[model samples]
Target: MKHQPINGQHHVSMLTKDAKQNLWFYTEVLGLRLVKKTVNQDDPSMYHLFYGNRNGAPGTEVSFFEMPNAGQTRKGTNSISSFSLLVPNDEALSYWASRLDSFEVPHEAIVSIGERKSLTFYDRDELTVHLVSAEKDNGIELVEPWITEDIPPKYVIVGLGPVELTVREASRTKAVLEDILGYTQVRTVPSMGDSKVMVDIYETGKGGLYTELQVKEVNDKDRERPGKGSIHHVAIRVKDVEELTEWAAKITAAGFENTGVIDRYYFHSLYFRDPNHILFEIATDGPGFEIDETFDALGENLTLPSFLEERREEIESKLHPIR
Candidate 1:
């Protein structure tokens, strides 16, 4: 049976120890435009910052939560091993490498993944990040010198590229991505242990940025504890709000408890989990980053959702000052 696929890449959110440091790295160093700044609805003390291309568009954003003084996370089974970002091309990568060196940020030389080249590096809090030159044709806008100059933000993001996750039961998690999420098994490659299997699901094209679920050999199985530098959630994109609602029903029918549609200001969202315990969200592509702020003024200040607007004073008081 052919299953309906979701649309573009929505966003990926991470937990951070220092919001200010992350803001500087993403905005000043990485060249991602800060689109929105708000607080966690449930826990207003923590600030939620969204960074991406020109306007924090879907498939381009990498959001973060500022949880000050959070504990360290264990890198093992049931955790997202690594996350990747797609740059425009090799030239963009070279530009980034030189900039990182100038900033005194330590990073490895380019590494090859098939025809793709990547610069693997760690964030200030130790979250693994990869800036890869993807083969996809992304028409999105990009800020050149990702660290130095000011350029108009681009709209192209090759969706979410290959999220590497660590899981004890590889086959079970693979089933969820394939059978439930409609992802197709692309190929399997040898990794540190058994074999690194890759499953891909695309809404736009065959290639481009897709999720990569990796099964790592672990000595034991354990629940992942939330901590600083951990991926709080990885969001996949659906075409629109209607598709998001359909996925909510599909996810619940599959026996996983799903959070119904959520208004994330820019887009609606639904969240569920795979058997391996990684949190996943299905978000819409409409009502984009420019819904509230103009394209030019994207990452300028704190932007709040209407629900949190009434409690702005309380939220600001709780969050630590992050310049």
Candidate 2:
């Protein structure tokens, strides 16, 4: 162990066309609890939705930037394609396959990558999602799941897995992931049936943070265009504000542009972009979703950061109601 800075993925944030539909899809379809319901701090006119486990655990978060009017995403090289979650075993994967089928949500049959079994699907915004089945010996993920009536606790998505980043080539992107972020390059493997395409695997602390780079030759004009159905950023985790600031200093020293430090109320944040312009965030583990509200009452009401406290009514007026 080379003293890992990033524990693993904290949360992945993306854009959605409709807040209500976003809510329904993650909560009703996927069975995630609406841990935090707030507005985008930068553009308070829009919403920022967060979905996580029962108590809004650290690695279980998947947030969104609800920008209904924004243009739709164009997938290509240099894009963060999908967000994945860890499932306990092959049986849990089978349960989810049938679960999504019953909901009429389109999903792919179980597939294999190395020794791992995965079930792929898309959310309402066309965001790609994967549920990877793993055994305890394969590093059983942080197992806190949002328990609800219909969704068995066994099948609830445990935590964030490898996020797929399809870039123009592997060199720059791999350097950023491995060199700058302190991730180890596990190996380079062939992608699908295309012997030309190389999928590079990078792993962080233990087995939590993983990223797959789908490297292919592409022209500058064909680079991915971020929009409605695209990922905003993937946040990696630090233990607390102290570790976060230290990482910030290291990131800046490594000749990368970082947003310094920000107070996100729930956690401290530092934002940066990789070599190919894919945004990345480094957020603290706590004070978490329970800072202001009780665990049982989490996400029950709209919450605002301290800076926006006085303008609550104004912010609420500009946004659409989501249940």
Candidate 3:
């Protein structure tokens, strides 16, 4: 269709029962850099944690909002069921399996997902995460991984991969992806675990490993009851505020209710929900994690935007130290 402003994934936001544990798992165990230490703008009392590659690139990040004492997720349909992180190749998969075992983290053995190998695991909050290989992918943009003594550059996570959404019916969501969002239906696969469950693959932006979306259709299932460990939303990339504004108009004209452009300090965003009521955000790629903090000092301090700087003391008082 017309020039598609939507790029690949921006970041997937999830809920965590303990920010401290979440920080440990994502940074120490998973080897992602703690890109930003900030509070959720919507609720300054709770902390919002961001983890990503060295640059905190748009497609590489996954964020969390702390919700202390929130109960376990009641899994079912109509949810952003899982999100995958991109690893370099099959060798990286093998390395991650060993690393995870040493850390006493439970993960399934590596298996083929489409044309690539994937190792599925859960976080402290039981958030489903897949470490998918980009071995067969040629179109995914490369980025700098966060390397540490335990995790070398070769085995580090590069960026976000496909995100899966489970719903009772897929027709409406498919329409939104294809008709409104300009994503093309690439293929469908019977679930590796259950042949009866079919997954439709849709791709936007560059239309490769990093840009894929999988929607699993299950006709009979109750809606999910989200609490801790549940995904809050999945955001896709827009070039900037100018591109985001155009996307807002397109989404609005297509009759989908949306949050008209909001300045998130780091980036501008527009939010909307799919037919299954799964939250989706379109976010810009600039004014990123390095705006306030130096490249060397990111995630080292409790950072607030200019608007929230005045309330830093009050915000810090409410948050439990994530270190």
Model 3: worst 10 consecutive residues (lDDT sum): 189-198
lDDT of 3 by residue, 1-323 (tens): 26554788999999999999999999989989999999999899999999999979999999999999799899989999999999988899999999999988888888875687888888889888988888898877878888888887888899999899898779988988888778888889865334467788898877887788899987677999999989999999988888888888889999999999999999999999988998989999989999999999999999998999999888888888767
lDDT leader: 3
What digit string (tens of lDDT, one per residue) describes model 2 on residues 88-132?
A: 677898999898888788888887666667888887777788887
How far in Å is the alpha carbon of 233 misplaced in model 1? 1.2
What is the C-alpha lDDT profile of model 1 across 1-323, one tens digit per residue?
33457543567789989989999988776766777877776677788888876556666778888877789886667776667777766666676677778877777787655555777777888888877675444433333322336522331223345566677777777787767887666555443112244423222334345444444544376757778888887788777887777778888888999889998878888887887788888888779877767877776767777777888787777776667
Q: What is model 1's C-alpha RMSD?
A: 3.8
State which candidate has the highest TM-score.
3
Q: What is the overall TM-score of model 1 with all chains considered together?
A: 0.85
Preferred candidate (TM-score higher): 1 or 2:
2
- lDDT of each prediction vs. the true structure? 0.69, 0.78, 0.88
Q: What shift in Å separates residue 298 of candidate 1 from its native position after superposition?
A: 2.0
- On the 0 to 100 scale, the lDDT of residue 99 in model 2 is 86
lDDT of 1: 0.69
RMSD of each: 3.8, 2.5, 1.4
Which candidate order results from sorting by lDDT in descending order? 3, 2, 1
